[model samples]
Target: MKRNYMYIVLAYGLFLGWLLSFPYNGPVLKHLVLIHQVPIASFSLVYTVVPAVFLIIYLLFFQIKEEYAKNIMNWSITACIVGTVILFTLPTYYWYPVLAVMGIGSVMYIIGWSYYYTMEIPIDEKMRIMALVIIIGNSIYYVINILHDQISIGFLLAVIIVPLIGAFRATSNIAVNNKIAVELEHEPLPVKLIFVICSFLFAVNITDGLTFHAIYPSFDQLFVEYFTFYGIMPYIITLVIIFFFGTKLSIMFPVFLGTSVLGLAYLSFGLMGKNWYSYFITETFLQMGWALLDLVLWTLFGLIASIYGRPLKICGYAFLANLLAVFAGGLLAVRILNKLDNYFIISAAFAIGIIFISFLIVPWLSEAIEKDLRNKLFKTNLQNKPIEEISPLSIPLPQREILTPREREIAELLIQGFTNKQIADLLHISENTIKTHTRKIYSKLDVANKRELLQLSFSSRMSKGRSS
Candidate 1:
């Protein structure tokens, strides 16, 4: 607990420094203050794009097999180092190190969340105290500016102090706040920690990128932004907002966050900034649209996760639901975005290609956001929901009759109300075996006669046909 607190403090301090640089405030801003100088955008290379790639790598590799502690830690540290170096280097990326430290805190928060919920361990007070110290220390930088005449930095520092404090406290003490979570047990800490940092990095990058851009149009990389999942991220993030809290009520969180992000993007593109309007518009649209869709889907994730007796079933349904929605949404988007960008006919092909590829990702965003929304909406309470659009009565797993594959096929046919001779004809099996198998099936199903056992089977088959 105390250890984490220390991390929080450092995160806060880092945030303070980054925030001060947001307005490009230095010792001489008073003579010539430029609000449009969003120095933070330069960090996008290190914070947003680079981390995005690393995360993809982490997920892909981590999912393949169990990642050992040594490997996970090595990669995690490597990622942090490379990210830090890039941030510390080029003028455009200098903001990296400044924000990266605080990004670490965000990662810690995720670790805390996962540990507290999934692993179910008691809070470590020591880590909490350390985090508290870091949080306070980070704020001290701001406090210094306030007392020392702004050093020309007073205003900028003040703007950052609050968020820094929150980040510190949340990141450091977060894990210590909770005492029990089983899910943490199986989770690879290194991999989870990497993504946690990523979440924060994305948050800061998105915030800084959009904020600075609003002040003044800058950068040529926006073509990539628009062509990427830029518009859809807000919706993707909506899932986390909802999931953080959990449940139906939590669903509102994504909407709230999505709305705010959209509003900010709108202000940046519509009223304040120019240059990257197309990309911003697309990103804003995806963000808001994902939120709307999340409200619908996350509720379902909650129901599916909780009510389905089988975990695999939960995954299966989730996969199918999102598959259908994404397929529908993707095909629909290709047709629409092409028409929407009709004015730019020369670049229409490029835009259309990007649109098609990006659409596939919507399923993930929609599914994720749905989970977040569900988590948030019902944070305070569990709500019964539509697990399935039509909740069909489920038959328990068929009795393990110890039948061979071919025998099971025969059984399935018989269960469909086929006569023994008909079942034999379908499977090219002899009638004598069909009869013998029927007797065996009835015996296994514990029916004194064929009538009772096959009665349930026939009823189930007929019902399935009717539903179909």
Candidate 2:
């Protein structure tokens, strides 16, 4: 970890130098879009294809046979790079017919790949549903890009491409690579609690890129459109930094998660669905927050190394917390957006408040999510034999799955001694609003009153060995 930190500090210093070296009006290294004269095939060979080859080579050379996960990692990056290219290369000068296939193929591949992300959830029939959704969403954006690429390639990428790829990397990487700790130490919760921080970094980085486009639409439209591929660089840097430097979950996780929630809440609810432009603007804020959030994550690492600890997990929570948060947030954001004619007013007010509350309280439900995971298939035969009705790996989250992102937050708040009024205040809604959200929290926690809620919270974590 220390080594990784050194790389980041050096990289950061060099990056700062480059930023300062540029003529303000001429070209900022951070924002400079690299253009290559090579053909798509040739450039992809160097960028996408070769990197894939390298990973294959590395894995083979090292005799690493974890094909499912490693392949997903390598190819997912390729999909994003190629997809970003196809998404951006329109109407400028380098539009290609193959881009259509590349775009579509990459989408399918990523969707297919995400299945292998976690040993807990491998590819199955369900993945088809996920793939179809991707196709539908991409088709809509594809049409939008065709219509407006000339005006602003960046906007489409920011709103569409970035999120999709971000989601892609998230689901796949976390599922496969991250560690699933059987329990937490209670004191300085490590991997489990680290999730909040990862989400913060992820949300902020994504939001940071989006912010540029929101404020400066034209430039962002082109530069960011192309740069979305490179946007992965910070995360890449983050991983490298983590690998060499060492980070602590207790320190980094909380701060990153807090920043991410606030920023993402601003993106989704801040504008309150005022318009497509609102989304554009809010997303821009989220993108900037992501980088700063990452810095916090790195700092968390610094603190950890100051002592002596290692992140027990990697892509698992680092990726999933962000994924699930976005999943839940997007679900809420869309519902509110569609249901409320005053979309902006309703969406912004509700999302921000809940987001804040969630930041304050999700660790409480760490138990429930884990409890459900542990006993999911456990049962005792009449005679006296233990049997698991289902493998935690195979059984999908039920239609009535436990703890949603919102409910989890509500649980946290409940434990924190947040009354309905306080929650309402934090969420920018009414007391009645708090009642409604609290009700959901109760259902998820399977308890009545604040007492049961707190009881369930502790019990759930204790089951998972997370006691703090």
Candidate 3:
């Protein structure tokens, strides 16, 4: 069963990789532009915007019930297959509609599969699984690029179909329960944390848009001329890094490293000028940096979804932010940056500024996110404990008046299993302050340890229940 699950994940990862790499590097979009006379910008806009719209709809109104998961997945995949066929065979007039269908289908399929996977998989294993999926998915695209000059329609069909079959067989018998959803209703959404994350993503992607044209003359130029050395090799190095260190490091490390490398890439373009050697150097760093950021983006969303138990909504909002940022960035790059005399230098400076800001801000962001997760876990642990384990005190808890208001707040968290450091993080105070508060809380409650404090708390609650 576990092996089958792994296969399903890998299959989806490969498709995801193809989605990420092919439109930019492979012949699909280029063929549409060269043969079918579809404008590159039009196709890009439809594909990007349509998915964003779908996510908006999903977030605002649509809810996927557990009973319909399989059907939604099946229909989404079918739509994608049909859209692919339309892209190949339909008239140029049908291109926009085809792209829209593909976009909507892709969003539905990705979110459906991802939500189910996150819900079913254990937390400890998720990071490693995500890393493997990313590596395989990306590696497959690069491998195909190396091996085939023109990917046949039949091969593309197989790529989509084979994965669909494997995923269906693996997940067909499984039933998802609504228990997590019910639990999620009780936990408040961490609005501040979500805002921070989305804002960071928006900033990162916008800069990517601003610098995109400066780095590559066109998408085809990168893969067509330097497919082997500059194109594939840098990504290979990135894959190796992700495979080895991705799961081992703190999540924020990648965010910092990726932004820094991106800064360097932009800096290279600014200093060295646009030539083959410079493009090679810039592209290498860009690929490595972008790959890391992409990995972090997906992983972070997955973590948020798992923690909140609202996978579709969380993932939907994240994708929406990403799409909008890319669109906004691309627009600015074309309209504003390209008109400037020193485009590369200005873009590089913007990127460098973003890196420095991230260095200053990412530590706080990491702590805020960590504090939320700790708080959630503390609540979950308390809820999941057996009733008998929460032994009631022979006497009631100490009177609330015994402690100051601040110490009362600290006592509540302490009884709820928050560590001193976690309390400090949550309350935005120093660890030393938390320790001082803890000592006062212990004195006021007449408790020696956390276990006794918890007992008194439970007893107080039970006593109130009996009296009322």
| Model 1, TM vs. native | 0.35
lDDT at 213 for candidate 3?
A: 50
Model 1 RMSD vs true structure: 14.7
lDDT of all predictions, in order shown? Answer: 0.38, 0.39, 0.70
User: Model 2 reaches what TM-score against the true structure?
Assistant: 0.30
Estimate the lDDT of model 1: 0.38
Which candidate comes out best when scored by lDDT?
3
lDDT of 3 by residue, 11-30 (tens): 46756665654443244465
Best of the two (1, 3) by TM-score: 3
Instruction: Give the winner by TM-score.
Output: 3
Candidate 3 at residue 427, lDDT? 74
Question: Which stretches of candidate 2 lie above 4 Å from their native place?
Answer: 1-191, 194-290, 294-313, 351-468
